[model samples]
Target chain A: MIFKIAWRNIGRNKRRTLLTAASIFFAVFFSCVMTSINRGVFDKMIDDSVTSNVGYIQIHKKGFWDDQVINNAMVYDQQWKQELAAIDKVQTVIPRLQSAAMISFGKITKNVLVTGIDPAAENKLTNISNRVVDGEYLNADDQAVLIGEGLAKKLKATIGDTLILLSQGYRGVNAAQVYPIKGIVSFGVPALSSGMVYMPLAAAQYFYGANNLTTAVVLDVAGKEDVEEVLPPLYAKLDTNNTYEVMAWQEMIPDILNLKQTKDSSNKVVTIILYFIVGFGIFGTILMMTRERQYEFGVLLSIGMKRGQLAASVWIETLLLGLLGAVVGIALAYGLAYYLMVNPIVMQGEMAEAYTKFGMDPVMPASVALDIFWEQALTVLTITTLIALYPAFVIFRLQPVTAMRS
Target chain B: MNIVTVQQAQKTYNPDKIPVHALQGVDLTIEQGEFTALVGPSGSGKTTLLNAIGGLDLLTAGKIIINNQDIATFSDSELIEFRKQNIGFVFQAYNLIPVFTAKENVEFVMLLQGKSEQERDTRVRELLTAVGLADQIDRRPSELSGGQQQRVAVARALASKPQFILADEPTANLDSKSTADLLDIMLELNQKENITFLFSTHDQRVIDRARRVVTLEDGKIISDERVS
Candidate 1:
């Protein structure tokens, strides 16, 4: 009987009920969209930095990350490669010999960070072959180099152009080489686009006079979120001594992680404000309903309805109303997020330039992760539950004689 | 037997500020199965006396005893339970729940009493038939006429078979014909079931039909008359 009364009571003022539900609906919708876009932007940032440049996890010789000199390079061991590959969740292990050198093309000379890679393994980690914009991709034995598009533009170098590279090799030996440009590649991050050069691992080791040496081994995991999971097994399989330093992307790039944390904190504040507004909207409706029905509550009380039962009935009504709004809101948010995920909103003009300057992609997409929908829905319902207590307090304190007179 | 006894009932409004006595040591007794009317002008304590006897308001002093139990000694929840089992009420505006159909309104009290479905259904049908609203059982109060709504209120009041029914200005919102029909139904129920009734009213028609009339003037009972 309480349930029946509660169900019917919701329809007593249809317009008021709809207005309350609509407020909740819009709150959930906007919060879901806002959080989804925020997360999607961060996901893009991580992809640009982690997937394209630094792998989700990296293995370097101790003290090499702090000092990138060629002398700190580790010995290239086939046994280490087999051990890393055997770990669960480790998708690919890419070996690289990296160093800084001065490149001269015609009269233009600029400093560039050169990385030597096994072409096939590098392609598996970063899909670098897909990023080739000009000329052909490099072979594992090619006596050639791939230059970033911005660097090529600055040097006025094109495919088949011979570029002069000079740097100190292992043990401070003079290292100089002339190699034809194999391809031109573009990166979303402006710094990487303007300062990177790639060559075959063997050719780079030969040029640097550091045969059988690699500066870093980048591990591509199944997902960036799985990086921590992959770490334990890799640590257990490799040398227990501190010879190899395992670094997750967050540890490798603390600045970007700090930026993401700040963004998330701000997003949380905005979401709380939205829920606060939603609570007021629902409370307003409840106040009106309780005030208007004061006399009816009196009659119910006088006719032997207990205060707890009456309160429970009203709470059930509010629960139903909140659930109705939240379900519809989640469905609509899911549809919108799914659409945005498939066809991301591309930034243009100044916005695109600003994003590129910050070393990020210019497009914004919504995350369709299932947690966003349920988390927002649960939050709105909790607010509704709290607001529903108002009517219960009124009913418990009601005097039937005065109420009926009113 | 005395079913209701009001002994030195005193109700003073705003005692801390300027005290306006609504019931000043008024006393009365009601026999079982009697149709009684408490009649007075505005602010003469007729409704105050009725409220005091119905346990709807606490008196400033004195005791109201029903079936040999002082209602003043009962707690708030106990009073509510006492009223549910012992007394019924009909308001001037016909306070039927707007969301419920006539049948559900009639069955509400019995539901509170935890009556079985079979018992509640039989009693609801019987009460609605008694009030001449058997055909309008499924209609909501909004769909019913003023007379029909009042009839539903009466049926709801009697649904639990209380010892007495207290009605405050039951005919104030009704037309003459509706009032006459309502009075006729109440008279029939009183005669057929021997159910006690007490009403506070300014309506002459309601006063004329009562077997006993108690008139108050200035918070004190002036006359108690017994008519045919």
Candidate 2:
């Protein structure tokens, strides 16, 4: 009966109901849009740092991460590859040999971190092959090299062009050689272009003069297993005689994880602020509603209504308003998120390259997470309902006789 | 059986530091099945006395007994419930809820009493029919005539079957013919249902028909006459 009365009362003031619901609608809608943008950007950042560059798992020589240019560079590439291949959820394992080297092209020489990769095996594991926009990648017999687009532009080198590389090889010996510039690659990363170079594994091994092997193995796994769960098994399979380490990508990419944490904190910051503003909007509507119905409340009180019930009845009105607004807002936001994900708003020129120039995916993406809708809707609605207590309680304390006398 | 009794009641208001004592230790008693008139000129305390007895206004110092329970000390909620179950009021202005229809206005009292659906509907229909508003049951207060609106108030007053009806110049806003018709209905209802009726008014027509009359002067009852 209380609910019946409340329902009738809401219908009695159509304008008040509309105003309150509109407040809730806009609040939830704005919150949905903002949260979608935040999540979209964060998800893309994570994809660029984690999924594309580093696999969920990576294997390395023991103590190499701590002191990469030191004694831990002591692992055989073939044995480790066979042992890693024995595990399930291990999609592909590609070995790499990295060295700090000085390379010169004619009169211009630059210091670089030279990466040695098995062209065929690395192609299967990473899509580095597909990134080649100029010249062919390393063939079976060719001592070809892949250089970042920026590095090539700086070095003024092109396909089939011979570039000299000079570096400190094993045993501190002077190592120098001539390798053809195989391809120039462009990635989203700004630094990768001018600083990094990829060479054939056999040629690097022959040039370094100290190994038939690699310093670390970068493993790319299937999604069936996560980092923490599969890394332990991969470790047990490794030479635990302190010879090798099976480190998860989480360790290698601490900066990425830290960045994600910061983004999450900021996401929460934005969500709270947006929802709070929405709350104020809804609250204003509820205030107007209660003030307009002050006399109605007085009548209900005089009619022997329990004050608490009266308040509950009013709150239920907001609940209905919230539910209605939430459903509509989420539905509208869903369409928006979908449209944006497909026909992504493209950033033009340097702005697009700037993000990609930094190894960050430039496309903005939005998630259609349902809980986001429920969370935002409930938050705004609950706040409006709580504000309703001022009016509902007013009825309890009101002197019906005096109120009527007015 | 007496449904209400008021003893030594007083209500004072201060306007610009000059105290206007509306009721000063006024005493009165009303019996069931009685049609009583409280007569006095403006500011003579008749309305104040009626307000105090109806539990609509608090007394400065008094004992108000309604249906044998002292209600002067009742809390706001308690007084509201007491009024809902025991007393119905008809104001000179026809105070019907603007949002509700004539039938819903009549159902207001029963709604207060927490009557079940079937009971409230049955009682509301009976009262509206009695007041000759059966055809106008769905019409809101704004749509009704002065006489029709006052009749709706009367229907509402009787809806909860209250023991006493307190009317403060109920016919003051109506035409003479409408006033005569309303008085006739009240007297007929009083005789048939044994529902007590009390009015605070200066209208001699009301006083002439009332079985008992109480006249007030200077905030106190000056005469109590048994006219029947």
Highest DockQ among the candidates is held by which one? 1
* Shift of residue A144 alpha carbon in model 2, Å: 5.5
Candidate 1 chain A least-lDDT 10 residues: A233-242
lDDT for A280 (candidate 1): 86
Off by over 4 Å in 1: A171-174, A209-212, A234-241, A264-281, A318-327, A356-361, B1-3, B116-118, B224-228
C-alpha lDDT score of every prediction, in listed order: 0.90, 0.76
Error of 1 at A55 (Å): 2.5
True contacts kept of each: 0.70, 0.30
The deviation in Å at residue B108 for candidate 2 is: 4.9
**If you score just chain A, what TM-score does every candidate get?**
0.91, 0.81
DockQ of each two-chain model: 0.66, 0.29
User: Each candidate's TM vs. the true structure?
Assistant: 0.89, 0.79
Regions of model 2 farther than 4 Å from truth: A1-27, A55-99, A104-108, A116-126, A135-145, A156-183, A199-294, A314-331, A360-362, B13-19, B72-76, B91-95, B103-114, B175-188, B203-209
Clashing pairs in 2: A188-A356, A188-A359, A189-A357, A189-A359, A190-A357
Q: What shift in Å separates residue A325 of candidate 2 from its native position after superposition?
A: 6.1
